[model samples]
Target: MNDHSTNKPIDESWVAHLRDLSTGVEPPTSANPHAMSRVAIRRTRTRRAVLTTGGGVLTVAAVAGAAFAIGSPTTSGPLLPGAPTSASADPSMSAEERRAREVEAAAVRALESGNVPAGWHVNVLEGLVYALPPEIVTSGPVQDEPGVTSDMWHSSEDPDSPPFLRMAYVTPDYEFYDTKASGLTQTPGPDARSFDLPGASVATVDDSAPLSEIAGAPEADPDRGLVKILVHREDGPGRYMITMNLGTADPEFVEGFLTTLTLS
Candidate 1:
């Protein structure tokens, strides 16, 4: 869990000290890492619905010569041209619009800091970074909330194929709590598990349905299973949820692909 190939371990104590110094108080120690509030559930549902319908305020950026690192060999190349320069500094934009722009820029920076396989198409959206096979197309940075964004991807030219992957980033708006009414409870069931990710205090994985399916349309394959990975920031208030809807994809491939994901 090194910071973006720095090979330097994150200083948790120093980070905590800084938080305390800035806030003049310590974060709550009793925050439950698992409880899901009604607001949170509703937020999640709204995000998925937007992804499913491919409807939202969309912004695209073209990242040329962006690089990223992964366990596999990688190559550097120009990506499709679409996105404009990050304009969070635009004086006319609302605070929410500025936040969304900043998140998208951070996502691009994350990709540029690493490398990817030669044939892969890198996706930078909503402060989440990952790569897809050449056959898949991705879209978004959909501003679900003031600070939350989502992206959806699926095979190209196949309108019938459901989006096999969706990713979202939620900026923490409240202090962490474990109570049933205000925080997240661990995703129930024996299949739920935890992961060790960089710069995260808690990372959990569990079964889920594709956001598209959750929105309404039934998946083409009833037997297909999707897995959701939730990662909570260690140094700040933010979290990322990545859904891999296992359709015709191999589970191992999905796991390996996730290794390339970068979040800010």
Candidate 2:
């Protein structure tokens, strides 16, 4: 009987075969101490790719900025809506005075225009009247008069906006009316109607109460964009904003315009 547990005579030929296999396996020598060099190379390549992509993005942004600057209008001779086309138009004022007048005229192009400028653009001067107090609205620098108000064109310019040309007028107290807003007034005609500004208060409005006003809010939806329609009364004179609608006609360009507001 063959004994399974007891040690059998060793096969010297098989042992020789195993030793040959072991000899075929190469071991790391002093020449190549670090075993995992492939991983490091891959990491280096990834870092280089990321840096290259970042540089390309910055280059594109710079190019776009340059293009915008170049395409916009530029003139050193005279400002629009002020300087006449002919050299002999107004030879009385000095160049400095002419420049100052040009700037000032450009700043108030609408009132200076006396009529809305042509071809720039126009949004609806939709007629909407509302009640306000005399103490809550004013027009100089901020709040001057409220209630009997008219369309005020104080907004960021856009081609699709309403009433590109705007004018504001003060409405009188004691009665509500409806009509076209040629200028701010409470004289309501068949076309005009009152507006609703929810929960507006007197401290912020700064004008007298029970006053009437009119303004234009374009047809675009303000809530969708971060852009909002701003209408409020402030304490300052000559500059109170009655209403503002902000947005982009382009879906991609929609954004808010004003940076600050004050009631006093």
Best by TM-score: 1
Candidate 2 per-residue lDDT over residues 1-264, each given as its tens digit: 986777889999999999999999998767543545777788999999998899889887787787567653233455578654754445566887866665454434432433332223322111212222121222224343445344444333444543222234333331322333333332223342333333222112211212223223332433322121323333212222233322223222211111111111
Model 2 lDDT on a 0 to 1 scale: 0.37
lDDT of 2 at 216: 34
Per-residue lDDT tens digits of candidate 1, residues 1-264? 765674789899999998888887657678554565766888999999987666433321112222222222132343348844334223468988777767667656655666455567666554556677777777544546555567777768683565467676666542222222222332333556776566777777765433334434354654565566777777766667667655544666666566666655
lDDT values for all models: 0.59, 0.37
Give the range of the ten consecutive residues with the poorest summed lDDT in model 2: 255-264
Best by lDDT: 1
What's the lDDT for residue 98 in model 1?
Answer: 74
